[model samples]
Target: MTGKTTFEIFLATVPGLEAVLCDEVRHKGFRSPSVVPGGVTIRGGWPEVWRANLWVRGTSRVLARIDSFHVTHLAQLDHRARQVAWADILRPEVPFRVEATCATSRIYHAGAAAERITRAIHETIGAPHADNDDGVLVRARFDQNVCTLSVDTSGDLLHRRGHKEAVNRAPIRETMASLFLRQCGYSGQEPVVDPLCGSGTFILEAAEIAARLNPGRSRHFAFEKLATFDAEAWERMRTVKSERIPSVRFYGSDRDEGAVAMSEANAARAGITDFVTFARATISELQPPEGPVGLVIANPPYGTRIGDKKSLIPLYRALGQTLLARFSGWRVGIVTTESGLAHATGLPFLPPPAPVPHGGLRVTLFQTAPLP
Candidate 1:
């Protein structure tokens, strides 16, 4: 497809962070973006889809809407699906898969819907269809009797930035970490500290942002397999050389020696070790990095995920007390599932935002102004 051709592109994000994702999209200079229930929508063509996958940080996936129509039954869906010019986007030699979901529609069988779409693609475009490990994904949703077809341009979830092999339990995804950093008003102009850094997601994400590195630089995208793909153009887009040397350094510390090692290794893999520091230190031993008062953000062990609820109270108390005593002049952002644990910190927090769903639990960012 030509870059001039316009189409709807959906930037999928976690439920509560749609606004934040939209803000990021808009700031990235994409055309008129609007917030929806689960994501943000913008109008563009194939290049925009590829660029979105390349530059945007908070989106979980980017879906390029192919077609949509109202259908009451399976026969109509099959007919309309066949009418779509799949060859324009999908290459016949590439393997593709269709996943379907039905809700409040007369055609209610998800498997049946997927089968029909698969048949349509096979018969019309001659593309090989498979159920396993296909690089191209077609998402068909039948909502309120209207079926919408979209192509998943991002093969892997955006958080898997092709780095960071080591992960601690209950680690925050890189996408959510970026959005939460944005929510805390972090502009990458100052230092960031994650006392409970698990595999250094926040510190690495902040480092990348400060350096203006493209999140999708190291990964391959599904769009590369499509007929619309321009290899030379993509090479030019990904290798634009826009990174800068950050003025401040990011810090991560954990009591576990293994976690400290994991963070160090992850930082080295991300090519930002020169701009980050990781060490083994408990929350009680937390100290601010000298030279600037920045943001101290931590995704501590929520009780449900790591331990008993009552047992974590003292941990929260100690974290709060240490920050209150020594980290004055620094802002704080804590991600937790329980309000009680957050309140135990005794920091004066601003009003909380909507809780974001993470790992089957709704987690909220409890943020505070610069500590006095």
Candidate 2:
């Protein structure tokens, strides 16, 4: 594999997260990234994929597209599976696994399909097959009468930054919060406050970005074990750093003291504790930083997984009144699975930009401008 090996990279995200994920990829310096429904597809070799795994903060998983073909039946699936140049993609010495999904095709038995694909790779490519339930997963999606094959370059979801030791009920994913922040036009230049800062995910994500910290710097990726992986090139790309430093405008507070402490610990682990302030304060008593215009972003509980909806209405109303009263000239972004709950904020607000699917639920990212 030489001469700028071209491979397909599939970036996966929750539904409606495509735009933000695309923006993050472009921000990380990918040239002409293309957006698809559930992800963005870009053409690059191992270097680009490696950098994506390291720098993209908004994506759920990064998959390298190795092969694809039309499969109407089990025999056709076996034939196409055997035809792929598996030796180029998988090393005979490395142990691997296969995962498959099928829809709208004659190959309806996903287990049998996966078994045939696995056998082909094992016999033809000489790659050892690992049992299911292993950490590493190879995903196969059969949709619209086409079979798409990809290898999960990310061992775990990218949002599991391994530093969040605790989580509150209805906690927001760090990646989702970061993408929502960007969608709200956060440039990290002004104060960012998360009032209902469960587990401190939003604040910590902002702090890390403001501090110019790479999200993947502390984690390992599956591509590191690939035969075509270039160690020296990966190290060089990983070592590239920006000279930007974080300011003290980032803050987070929660009514729950336990959440405040968890946010503090997460910030410390990410090495941005100095750039953020966490406090146990209710939304009614929340105060903006003493400065110019800034951003207030939060993923308040929606009574779906955690709290009582009837009880949370007061919290939402208080949040709305507090922001309207104290946060003039500042920008606000709120994420909630229930728009009706978000509407209780009661600020003269525009309709949400769009609703995005998150964790088997649909969430809308709502924004508002401070009054004159």
Candidate 3:
């Protein structure tokens, strides 16, 4: 039987930002969150699982490590799967799906392993299995003959904050955007600005954070479907509220009016419109808001998605000029795939972090400490 107060939990993240997610998890009070490949692992009960989904902005999803055992072959896998106490976690009336993967193991066929587990579940717990994409997912991975099982507790990726109803091509995922902000040393205390704010994701995130609003406040999680989930406790957990008088506001400007409008609508949906401003203007038109200088960050086009590198150099140059000329005291963070393009900005950035995979390209965030 699983302990009533604790369970194994993994916070999923992209490969490059494992340390970033780990920092966020530790800051959020998770017990002994350790960095692991493709994610972070923490041992906690259902409330900790729910809180991670709701409050930790850097994770892509939250996974509960439900069960595991050793199995050399399909028959052993089937026998062990049948003995697992599925009724302790899953409801017989609710449907689920299994996805199995095997590597360097005797049971090498993923489909056969999945079928065996599904049949066992049907016979043991009476919960019908559905297609993988549509229902609660039970993931089985057999690595080196050890079968491990987990359930995806966050259904839609946590990046889908459920508030951004509109976006343009190549919009950054909200989770990545939040991690980028944290990497930039933004604590939501100082003003933030995004010159190429495609859908105002950065601005909205900054505002909500400054106001002490939870990132998952407006959404639901897949854990709600599990038998261990307590609806009454979850309701109370989500209702825990905090309000802050933000220390400063956020600002964004984009050359495309359509992007500006989209950012505005997204901010309204997130209930952070009052703390942020979006205007249709070119990068050359960007000016610091009325406050102490803060961080100026942008996810400018990197030629792979929008245009030629030669064509974007002048745009980057103009951005560099604007910051150097008018915003002397502020810091800067730029995301781009091309080192040449980043050099084009002419800002004295520290060494770049390891490249992060985004939109099919390996991109890095080039950041500067406060400018002289």
Residue-by-residue lDDT tens digits, candidate 2, 7-40: 7888888777788889888887886789898889
Per-model TM-score versus the true fold? 0.97, 0.94, 0.97
User: Which of the two, 1 or 2, has more TM-score?
Assistant: 1
Better of 2 and 3 by lDDT: 3
lDDT, candidate 1, equals: 0.92
Report lDDT per candidate.
0.92, 0.82, 0.89
Clash counts for the predictions, in order:
0, 0, 1
Count of clashes in candidate 1: 0
lDDT score for residue 327 of model 2 = 84
Write the residue-wise lDDT of candidate 1 on 246-295 in tens digits: 99999999999999999999888889989999999988888888898999
Residue-level error in angstroms, candidate 1, position 325: 1.0
**C-alpha root-mean-square deviation, candidate 3:** 1.4
Candidate 2 overall lDDT versus native: 0.82
Error of 2 at 135 (Å): 5.6
The TM-score obtained by model 3 is 0.97
